[model samples]
Target: MKILHRTEIEKILSSLDPIPKIEEGFVQYSKGLATVPPVGELLMEKGEVHIKYGCIRADEYYVVKVASGFYQNDALGLPSSNGLMLLFSQQTGQLACALLDEGFLTDIRTAIAGAIAAKHLAPANITAIGIVGTGIQARLQALYLKKVTTCRQLIVWGRSAEKTGDYQQDMQREGFEVSIADSIDELAQSANFIVTTTPSTTPLINVSQVRQGTHITAVGSDTPEKQELASDILARANLVVADSISQCQQRGEIYQALKAGSIQGEKVVELGNVIAAGQGRADEQQITIADLTGVAVQDIKIAEAVYLASEKK
Candidate 1:
């Protein structure tokens, strides 16, 4: 079996177009062409590991991805997330390649998914993009949104002042008009499109803070205890979308909303359905919310792309 290191996988991924590939995976998933089992998780005191695996019916390879995150790793001078993907041939059930991507692949695919969510759900005209949390995802989400939207202004809110300032400076150098917001409410009120990437157990953005026609793509709450937006905010949205209805029902922002009884479980729409049908949001005045908990099909598609690209080289 071939072993591809993180650096090699990163190189292969840099040349690949992830948005189309990810969108295709979502379409396939919604069309019942992909087999995705329930996500497995192992929670720890300081970190968590997630096991996601899936296969497309017509694909030659299936993927099993192991991803982990430890917030305390920052103090130890190490990255928080690092994991690998195991590829197996569907025809022969033989091991194909082991991609030690160390979660780089996950980050890119997730950012692309965020972009896809905005493309279908966010308003056609965007004044400003609001970002919560000044981490790798915050940077990636802002950069990818530029490709799908023409918004020039970026407003960011972070728990740390220094980190938020650093994010503002870095994004400014990257040709974005970025500003650090004093609070989440300020960012919510100013920007029409907001992406929340913080791993917070408590809600940060409330219902009263949002304006009419606001669109929020929530990406941080992958676990049961992690929630970024208030339950009331979801109830107030004109439409709510989920990447995986089953996964979100068990965890993510949707789970929190459902448990609080703020929104009915049946109201949330799967994002793939919107993508496959090429339909969503009838008017610009409608408020939209996308709860993205990530999915295994995304891993299979991205891993397949990188593996094929590597083989071509």
Candidate 2:
């Protein structure tokens, strides 16, 4: 099997628009259009806790994603998140290839979810951007934001400024007008499009701080018990969209909102319905939210993109 490195995958990504498009396609895939079967994930709490999972499509393609616990970095001096994508030839049942290093493929897919949120929810003339959390996920989301929107002014708020100055410097190097905010509430008030990428259990942005017409993309809440936004902020949304209602119902920020009696399931809109039915927020005046919890379908779609991208390289 051919192995793809991190730089190789990134170079392939540079020549493709699949990152954002795959998110859109995943919206379609989740809506009962594409034939993505269930992906199995198993969480094992041992020496290094992790979730190992794989997907199947009979004789087509199957991929597996393994996400280790956040503390894995402490032992290895590497980023906590890392995985391999194994691709097999469905027709011949041959092991076609393997992206044996870096979980960067998933990073691109997840970041594109934020990009899609901005494309669908943010105004055409998005002026400013605000981000909570300064992790790798936050950086990737900001990179994709620069790709998808025209937002010039950027603000960031992290749990500790001292720990994440590297994040600020990285943004500045990219030519983004970046600043570090003193508080989460400040970020909500200043930017028209806000992305929450923190792995926080508590709310960062307050409802009162958010201005009307703001578009918020809440990531990092992939599993139950990992919430990032306050329930009241959800209640303030004029339009709320999710990657999957079922996925969000079990985990993600929206699930926390539901537990708090802040929003009903009926108030939520899946991005698939928004894409297929062509009915979502319009104009620049509506307050919109896109809650991304990350899904297997997204993994499958990006894996497909990686396979197609590998065909050329």
Candidate 3:
């Protein structure tokens, strides 16, 4: 079996545009053309690990990914995210390649998925983008959004003032007009298109703070214990979309909202269905929220793409 390291995987990703593939993966998944089992998770005192595996029915290979986050790793000068993906031949049941991406692929697929969410769900006239969190995902979400929206103005809010300042400087260097919001309320008021990328267990954005015509993509709550948006926000949203309805029933903002008796299960729609049916926000005045818990089909598609690209080289 071939083994590709993080550097090689990064190089491969640099040459690839994964948005289309990820979009197709979601469509296939929602159509029942993919096999993705429930996520396996291990929660620790300072970190968490997730094991996701699945295969697209039409694809030649299946993928297994293990990704973890140690919240306190930064003090040791190490990236908190780390993991790898394994691709196996479906026909022979043999491992075909090992992608030692160290969670880079996971991050890329997620960011691309966020862009997909924006492409289908965001408003046409996006004045500014609001980013909640100052981590890697906050940066990637904004960068990937450029693929779907032309809006380069950003207002960011984070718990740490220093981190928000750093995020502003970093985004400004990338040609975006960045501003730091002192609170989530300020960020919500300034930008209609918001992306929340934090692992906070408590709600950050409340329904009262959200305005009409706002689209919020919550990506940090892959686990049941993590939540970033108020349950009332989902209850108040005109449209609520999930990357996977089944997955969201057990995790993410949807689960929290459902548990709180704020939103009904029938009100939730899968992201893939919305994409396939070409259905999104009915009007610019509607408020939309997409609860993204991350899906294994994403790993299957991205891993297969990287493996195929390596052969071409």
Candidate 4:
């Protein structure tokens, strides 16, 4: 079996557009064409590890991914995210390739998925983009968002002034006009398109802070304890979309909202259904939210794409 590192994987990915593949994966998953078991998680004192694996029906291979996040890694001058994916042949159960991406694929697939969410659910005319958190995902979300929205103006907020300033500089280098928001409310008031990427246990964006015609993609809340948006925000939204309905029923912002009795279970629709029906933002004034807990199909599609791309190279 071939073993590829992050450098090789990066080169392979440069030639591929993951948005469409990820979008298709979502559609297949929502249609019940994929089998993704419940996520396996381990909580640590300062970090968490997630084991996600699955395959699309009739696909050539299945994937098993193990990724972790240690928030304090930055202090040690190390990346917070790390992991790899193992791809195996479906028919023979033999190993095909090992992608030692060091969690780069996971990050890229996630960012692309955010772009997909924005493409389908966000308002056609975006005023400004608001980003929460100053981590790798925050930067990548803005980078991938350029695929769907023409708006290059970003308002960012984070807990660390130093890190937030660093984010501003980094994004500015990427051809985006970046601004540092003094508060979440400030970020909310300025940007119509918002993506939350922080792993906060408490809600950051409240219902009153959100304006009409706003589209919020909550990406940080994948576990049961992590939350970014207030439960009232989901309740107030005109349209709420989830990457996986069953996954959302257990975790993410949707789960919190449901548990709080703020929103009904039936009100939440799958992102794949929205994409398939070509139904999104009814009007410019409607409030929309897409809760992404991440999915195994994403890993399957991305790993397959990377492996195939490497073969061609």
- State, as a TM-score between 0 and 1, how close model 4 is to the true structure: 0.97
Taking every candidate in turn, the Cα RMSD to the unseen true structure, in Å, is 1.2, 2.6, 1.0, 1.1
| Residues 145-176, model 2: lDDT tens digits | 77777676889988776756888888889878
Q: Candidate 4 — which residues are off by over 4 angstroms?
A: 44-46
Q: For residues 73-145, could you state the per-residue lDDT of candidate 1 as single tens digits? A: 9999999998999999999989999999889889988998899999999988888999999999999989889
Q: Report the candidate with higher lDDT, 2 versus 3.
A: 3
* TM-score, candidate number 3: 0.98
Off by over 4 Å in 1: none
Model 1, global lDDT: 0.91
**Descending-TM-score candidate ranking:** 3, 4, 1, 2
Report lDDT (Cα) of residue 251, candidate 3: 92
- Comparing 1 and 2 by TM-score, which wins? 1
Query: What shift in Å separates residue 103 of candidate 4 from its native position after superposition?
Result: 0.7
Pick by lDDT: 1 or 3, better one = 3
lDDT of 3 by residue, 174-266 (tens): 989999888888999989999999989999988899999999999999878999999999998999999999999999999999999999999
How much lDDT does candidate 2 score? 0.75
Q: Is 2 or 3 the stronger prediction by TM-score?
A: 3
